[model samples]
Target: MAWFILIFSGAVEAVWAAALDKSAGFTRLWPSLIFLVACAISMGGLAWAMRSIPVGTAYA
Candidate 1:
């Protein structure tokens, strides 16, 4: 379950990065919103997983 969460978080990070690039300095409202939401969810999941595992180990 933890591994799944970690992987999902990583996927979200990738999506957020791509969306941010598409946003182009916030010129695109939809992509900007997507990036913000994805990043928030990814960070929240990462924080939850980090509580039980060391940051290095969790990332690895």
Candidate 2:
């Protein structure tokens, strides 16, 4: 379960990274919003997984 969350978080990280690229330094409102939301979701997933995963392993 923790590994699943960690993997899901990584996928979300990819989403946030792509959204950030589209954001163009936040010049565009929609893409920037997408980036922000994705970033939050990604971090939230990572943090959630941290409850069951060791920090070192989670990072890996």
Candidate 3:
């Protein structure tokens, strides 16, 4: 479960980056929203995964 979430989160990180780029300095509403939501999900997953996986291994 943790591994799945972690992997999903990693993939979401790419989406987050793309959204951030598409946000156009946050002037674009939809992309900005997607960026925020993706950031939250990615961070949340990373935190949750950290509870089960070692920080070093996860970071590596």
The candidate that wins on TM-score is 3
lDDT per residue for candidate 2 within 2-56, as digits (tens), equals 7888899899899989988988899999989988898898899899999988999
Across residues 1-60, which tens digit of lDDT does each residue of candidate 3 receive? 999999999999999999999999999999999999999999999999999999987766
Error of 2 at 59 (Å): 1.1
Identify the leading candidate in terms of lDDT: 3
**Candidate 3 deviant stretches above 4 angstroms:** none
Worst window of 10 by summed lDDT in candidate 1:
1-10
Candidate 2, which segments miss by more than 4 Å at Cα?
A: none
Better of 2 and 3 by TM-score: 3
Q: What is the lDDT of candidate 3?
A: 0.95
lDDT of 1 by residue, 9-53 (tens): 999999999999999999999999999999999998898888877
Per-model TM values vs. the true structure: 0.90, 0.91, 0.95
Residue 44 in candidate 2, Cα distance off native in Å: 0.6
Q: Spell out the clash pairs found in candidate 3.
A: none
- Each model's lDDT comes to 0.91, 0.90, 0.95
Please list all clashing residue pairs in model 1, or write none if there are none.
Answer: none
lDDT of the structure predicted as candidate 2:
0.90
Order of candidates by lDDT, top first?
3, 1, 2
